[model samples]
Target: MSATPSWQAADGCVHTGPLLQSVNGFDVVACEACGFSHTLPLPTPQELEHIYSHEYYTQEKPLYIERYLEDKAWWDEVYAERYERLEAELPAGRRRLLDIGSGPGLFLAAGRERGWNVMGVEPSERASSYSREVLKLDVRSMFLNEETAPTLGQFDVVNLGEVLEHLPDPAGMLRLVHGLLAPGGMLVALVPNDFNPFQRVLNESMGVAPWWVAPPHHLNYFDTDTLPRLVQRCGFEVRHVETTFPIDLFLLMGHNYIGNDTLGRQAHAMRKTLEMNLRAGGETGRALKSRLHRAFAGLGLGREVLAFARKIDDSPSPA
Candidate 1:
């Protein structure tokens, strides 16, 4: 586990708090300097490469692809909302997008179907292969690093969904994305909102173990505040922030899904049902849900956070 007295985060913030919790034998600590939390002894580059390229889909989560296929309709709805939001900010005829860690290339496909120029970079061999062979999407089977970033060219929007938490140096990744973005381009980063009030309530008040803290897979933890701060520090102007449905509310309401697969499925089903029903109600229903979720985001209560930022234009001022 390599437990240490203090650890320096990628953003130059040092974390010195005592161990917050240990999950799967890895120690986690909170960074008072940056209001972030992460695991100790981050994995090496080689280890990360092997894990993602080989073991991630095959060994770590064998049924991920199947489950994703099952929820394809719902996934499309989620992607549509994001695309609509980002497109609203863009001028007419500018819809180039690059999705990092684009698992199975579904997001890219959705964007392309919406008449947007889309590309993806995914490290997982199985997932990337599926994206290419099955989905016929333009997904590169490699990680997004300095060497590869330049070749990808500029993008109007960069999407990083559930990606930063898995990295050892998230700031470095964002910096690369900054360079890849066209002037005034947007960056959409979606990550799980951890260590929030709801999660603390579930862990402390309820008998739920810290189920969200999955080490080796998720090395960094971020809430809405910390995530925006990180993105802004990387030379982006934070535009909008919102959260998805707080699934933990089910647990809070006596539907204990912790450690029970059946209850967990039921809870997820109910949540999806509510969202699907609201979405079926057309524009009014969509607006209502958006307002409700925005309120939840303001309170920092959600299962996941979606932040939209724009690359700060650095053009020289005319004399």
Candidate 2:
């Protein structure tokens, strides 16, 4: 692992304030010059690999994928809408895409299905193999660093889906992504909106970590406000912004087990959680909840958000 960055907070992430007791384990500090409310005590490269290989992500096949693939027509319509929006502003045809941390190669699958030439960079051997063998796509098993980046030409579109916050240094990673873009290339990034309402309520009540809080996996958090700054720091200019993925199952999972006994026990926990969630709110309730969620999301409460930016000109900076 690289030496612990000089910018890391000496006292670590936890600190004291009047309103908030302890802000979990994150090391938050305002930059002396820019006053960015960002996390410090960022993970080292070694820490990053440990967190990613931990039990949290070892399990494959999240329930959402199963549901998404089973309902092909529905997912098609949804992706079409998304594809139109996410790709509309950028130039079409002759577009080569690179998806970092392409687990299970879902986006690559979509790209291939759409006839887009896509390449993936993943560190996990198992996931990379699955992406290649199962999805029949090309994938490279390597971390994104100076040594690992391919000398291949710049890409036209880069996708960083649920990937930036997982890095030890988001600023550095964004700079690297910027270097790999062709002229006028656009970057499509999606991270969990750290300031979402459900997250606020969860942290206020239960001290339990949100699923997105998997230690070491998520070392940084970004919202709409801070995200653009980070992007500009890495040398890309913000072109478009959209908060998406309003139908989040993670919050539903939490609302299911909240205030609930027999949650951590064996025997029917998953089944019971599903039953309780479906019962407290059947699909009808979930549908209405999604509608309400969209309304709140328009007000900035979406669980996930997708931001688009372009490399206006070359202006890469140092760490």
TM-score per candidate, chains pooled: 0.93, 0.71
Q: Candidate 2, which ten residues in sequence have the lowest lDDT sum?
A: 13-22
Query: Candidate 2: which pairs clash?
Result: 13-26, 13-27
Candidate 1, residue 147: Cα displacement in angstroms equals 1.2
lDDT, candidate 2, at 136: 90
Per residue, candidate 2 scores C-alpha lDDT tens digits across 1-319 of 2222125344353422212111455544433422233445556687667555543335533443444444444334444444565467666665588888886677677777877788998777767777899889888877778767655457888888888767756666777887888888888888877745666666666555554444345555566666767776777888766565433334446544433424422223343344335335766865564365346545666656667788877574645
Off by over 4 Å in 2: 1-40, 53-56, 59-79, 205-212, 245-254, 257-298, 316-319
Per-residue error for 241 in candidate 1, Å, reads: 0.6
How many backbone clashes can be found in candidate 1? 0
lDDT string for model 1 (137-207, tens) is 99999999989899998899999999999998788898888888889999999999998889898888876
Per-model tally of clashing residue pairs: 0, 2
Distance from true position, residue 66, model 1, in Å? 0.8
Ten-residue stretch with the least lDDT total in model 1:
1-10
